[model samples]
Target: MSAEKKPAPKVEPLRKTRPCPECGKPSQREHYPFCSNRCRELDLSRWLSGSYAIPVAGDEAMADGEDEN
Candidate 1:
């Protein structure tokens, strides 16, 4: 009986990141982690501006205020 040979495992190709997530510009060498300083700052601005808000249960003071109203 002839033995069947299994195919080699598939490998993913290496890709270079091109665009800045914040502004969609081609990445530059100065910004190793990010495409540019603007993108980095934009991310920070989003955090500082409450762009990623999370809901939480009201505390005693907040509950009291709501109850009064």
Candidate 2:
């Protein structure tokens, strides 16, 4: 039998930390870095209010593609 030894398994790094994107305070899991549900909701409201958007092709462009014209 050989005397070679296997190396230990590698461990994963801890989560990245940052101040709450909303309140600029330390983040926690329960409130998820926002401090509270109220803050979380406030952040969500901004997203829903067209403050954040993903671009999509206009209806006319899509129609032309379908017909290959």
Q: Work out the TM-score per prediction.
A: 0.42, 0.50
- Tell me the spans in candidate 1 whose CA falls farther than 4 Å from its real position: 1-15, 54-69
Evaluate residue 68 in candidate 2 and report its C-alpha lDDT on the 0 to 100 scale: 52
Model 2, span 1-69: residue lDDT tens: 888888988875555566888888776666765767878999999999988887766787676667555
- How accurate locally is residue 57 in candidate 2, as Cα lDDT from 0 to 100? 65
In order, the Cα lDDT scores of the candidates are 0.75, 0.76
Clashes of 1: 0
Error of 1 at 15 (Å): 7.6
Clashing pairs in 2: 27-33
RMSD of each: 7.8, 6.3
